[model samples]
Target chain A: EAGVTQSPTHLIKTRGQQATLRCSPISGHTSVYWYQQALGLGLQFLLWYDEGEERNRGNFPPRFSGRQFPNYSSELNVNALELEDSALYLCASSLAFGTNLPDTQYFGPGTRLTVL
Target chain B: SQKIEQNSEALNIQEGKTATLTCNYTNYSPAYLQWYRQDPGRGPVFLLLIRENEKEKRKERLKVTFDTTLKQSLFHITASQPADSATYLCALVRPGGKLTFGQGTILTVHP
Candidate 1:
């Protein structure tokens, strides 16, 4: 009955350094998604992993990447971070059954990454 | 390409009144549309879902309307309370199983 959980409620790092954010999906969920929410930018899609494969990604650059574990947890790694990279990183999970899943996505509390 | 949009301005409604929010999209025919509630410093929580074929859906005090022709969705909170204040987001899954979220609209219900 636990919802999605993320580590490092807050993160602070300098520009040019790498940042790693972790996410654990709800129990029994198989699809994990990553999103970045910043001022004015809204919640932008970053990546989607299903069944341990990189299924789809958003308009973000290649430096933004992630992997889903066999247990359905995931990690997002941002390389060459810039000042603009600072934002709340959210992780979501959904059932892999397909369209009938109601397309309902449950989100995590998120990791607030502040790049200085 | 595909895009989703929501009212960017904050909506202020008096407690016990009804609040209406809008979600619109372009360049895609989604099978289903969703509504989520998010609070400050936290991620979004699933609120409701309505399929394209369906006209309306209601959960507790929330009601969602979908219009495929208009490519728009409406979210309504009836008998609102001060605790209802939060940002509401709309999202849709593409044919490829990727979800696209709207910018979200902030709702502030005052007592």
Candidate 2:
């Protein structure tokens, strides 16, 4: 089966601009998660979407937001991007939450966002 | 505040040896702990998951041990190979499904 896929392997945006990153989850998966990995840093949770609803979010600012579509794909939008926003944006998908089994997330290769 | 810590930033070992990595958390009671492998410029791949009720789990040459009382997890690879070189991340998942990750430990198995 095809794993989660993300678009635009690399993206470059100037400061104060808006950037949009897209992700398509694996087939039959309904939960999509977004994370940011800064240079030399750990992965930081960004957003969680399940069944077209925003279930949770991390400590990121409001400028960082995203939405999940009916088909279970997701888009992450960064408004007025800053140099600090330059990082690798990763997307992951898993089976619907609250199941009897563990919800193990499968990740896409990720988009490298470079904010100048 | 919830915090997760890996044992080190990097580990180097000769091939065919056993490599052990550690993950510890503070101020959090996770229902499950997971390990993932991430290579440079790629997303993390799921490795193993151990629940609080389970003390240990193994898959092939990989083994994971979870200690709830100490709030720690240990990941081990026996007879390691150069292919095992990568950053290993540990994540904690709460009962509600919120996951918090730690800074990964980069393992280098030299041939």
Candidate 3:
């Protein structure tokens, strides 16, 4: 089966610009998650979307937001990008929770975002 | 605030040896701990998951041990090969399905 898929393998944006990253979950998966991995850092949770609802978010600022579509795809929008915003943004998908689905999350090849 | 930590330094070991990595957390009671393998430019791939009530889990040559009382987990690879070289990440699953990760530990198995 195809794993999670993300678009725009690489993106470059300048300060104050807006960047949009997209992710398509694996077939039959309903939960999508976004994470940011800054250089030399770990994966920081960004947002969680399940069943077209925003379930939880990390400590990131409001400028970082995203939404899930009816087809279970997700989009992460980073506004007012700063140099610190440069990182590899990862997307993961799993079967919706509480449906007796195992908790293993399959990740997609991340998008490398370079903010200048 | 909750924090997760993994050894930032890269681990070097000869092939056929066992490689062990550590993950520790503070101020968090996770339902389960997960391990993932990541290449230099790729997203992490799921490796293993151990629940809080479980003490150990193993898959093929990979083994994971969880100590809830000590708030720590250990991942082990036996008879390691050079192909196993990569960054190994440990993640803590929060109550509501969020995963908090630690900076990964890079493992280098030299032939």
Candidate 4:
């Protein structure tokens, strides 16, 4: 089975620009998560979507947003990008919502966004 | 609010020895604590997941111990090798079912 797959393995954008990164979750997986892995920031959760609905989000700003599709694919959008936004944007997939059974997340290779 | 913490410093140990990493948390309880291994320029790979009620779980040479009392989890890699050198991350299941990660601890196994 294809693990979670993300588009644009690497991205480069200038300040004030907008960036869109995409993700396709594993087959039959209904939950997709987005995380930002910046230098010194480790990995921080940005959003969690289940069955195409926004379930939860992290402390990230409004500029950091994303949406999930019916097929469990997701896209993360960062607007008015800043230099600090240059980091690895990872997308993960899990089973259905509210199910904690071995609720481990399977991640994609990630989109490395570099905002200049 | 719940906070998870790991050693920000890098750990260096000789090969063939056991490498132990720690993850500590404060405030509420977690349903399960998970361990992940991440290489440079790569996404994190799931290592092990131990539930709150479970004391210890092992897979191959890797072992994870969860102590809900201490609100901590310990990850161990026995007979460590140079290939085991990477950053190990710890995560806790949040109230809404999201996984909250801590700052990973980089482990370097000297040959």
Query: Which of the two candidates, 1 or 3, achieves a greater TM-score against the reference?
Result: 3
Scoring each candidate complex against the real one, what DockQ results?
0.64, 0.64, 0.62, 0.65
Candidate 1 stretches with Cα past 4 Å from truth are A97-102
Cα lDDT of model 4 by residue, A1-77, tens digit: 88999999999999999999999998988999999999767898899888898888899899988898877799999
- Write the residue-wise lDDT of candidate 3 on A10-108 in tens digits: 999999999999999999999999999999888899999998999888999999999999999999999999999999999999887773333689999
Give, for candidate 1 chain B, the lowest lDDT window spanning 10 residues: B93-102
Predicted complex 3: CAPRI docking category = medium
On residues B48-80, what C-alpha lDDT tens digit does candidate 2 reach at each position? 999889999999999999998898899999999
lDDT of 1 by residue, A20-104 (tens): 9999999988999899999666788888888898888899999999998888899999999999999999999888846534247
In model 4, how large is the Cα lDDT of residue A111?
Answer: 96
Error of 3 at B111 (Å): 0.8
Clashing residue pairs in candidate 2 (N, C-alpha, C atoms within 3 angstroms): none
Candidate 1 residue lDDT tens string, B1-111: 778888656899999999999998998788789899999889998988888799999999999999999999999999999999998989887577767788889999999
Arranged by TM-score, best first: 2, 4, 3, 1
What lDDT, from 0 to 1, does candidate 3 have? 0.92
Clashes of each: 0, 0, 0, 0
Better of 1 and 2 by TM-score: 2
TM-score of chain B of 2: 0.97
Error of 1 at A92 (Å): 0.6
Model 3, runs deviating above 4 Å: A99-102
